[model samples]
Target: MGMQPMEWTENALIKRSTDFGKLCALHERDPEAASAKLETMMQTVRTMLEHVGVADVNNVEQASIITEILTKKFRAMHDREPETTEETNLIRSFAQIHARVQQAHAALQRQNGDKDTSNKSPNAPHDNAVPPAA
Candidate 1:
């Protein structure tokens, strides 16, 4: 039987939230904070998933799921307007990260789909193929 999929338990969510907060704290003060933080955030997520046994950290579907979860958590937790410059910076960085993640996933999906079509057998029947004569 195929292995069971990893469950996103409460504990895992809490741990990820804490990690994200810490990462934001560390990057919010940097000069190129937004870009650097976004890059680090992506890498951190990839590392987190790799450690948790996700077969492919760069898998488009997995990345999309993680991005969606994180985006929801972030919106819920930071619903209020930013009260400080640091908070504003963090939010901006998060927005950029979210947008980039979405774009990357779309691109990867398209690339994979193209490869799938290209790899199809030459003799395989396609939707547009003409019917054979009796």
Candidate 2:
């Protein structure tokens, strides 16, 4: 069944990634044309990332997560034998980008998580106040 409108989700992204098989078939039929199309597609995705200000100061973590999700989807789609160096690099680049995003996301989550828990920590300034006389 077709997905309902505005129903985009991580699962939906993962499911859509399987459509890469069409690109693979095209590559088999017309390697030169497929290469050009793939390059254009990659450039378009990079442009979209730039438009969203990914890996930038504003909304850093969220943007990084979005980049990571896209990288993951691309990685899943291309996790197969590569016929050329360019194809191999494409896979490698996505994996590398995904790793970097995952690391950055984890660091940000940890940093934010610590701030959230600090106030409630037993050793926090307010929590360490001396008891009042009864």
| Clash count for each candidate, listed in order shown | 0, 0
Off by over 4 Å in 1: 1-14, 21-43, 46-58, 113-134
Q: What's the residue-level lDDT of 42 in candidate 1?
A: 64
lDDT of 2 by residue, 113-132 (tens): 45666344342343333354
TM-score for candidate 2, residues paired by index: 0.47
lDDT of 1 by residue, 3-63 (tens): 4555455575566666665554554466466456666766666544444342332553454
Name the Cα RMSD for model 2: 12.0
Q: Tell me how many residue pairs clash in candidate 2.
A: 0
lDDT of 2: 0.52
Residue 34, model 2: lDDT of 74
The true-versus-predicted C-alpha distance at residue 61 of model 2, in Å, is 9.3
lDDT of each: 0.54, 0.52
- Candidate 1, overall lDDT? 0.54
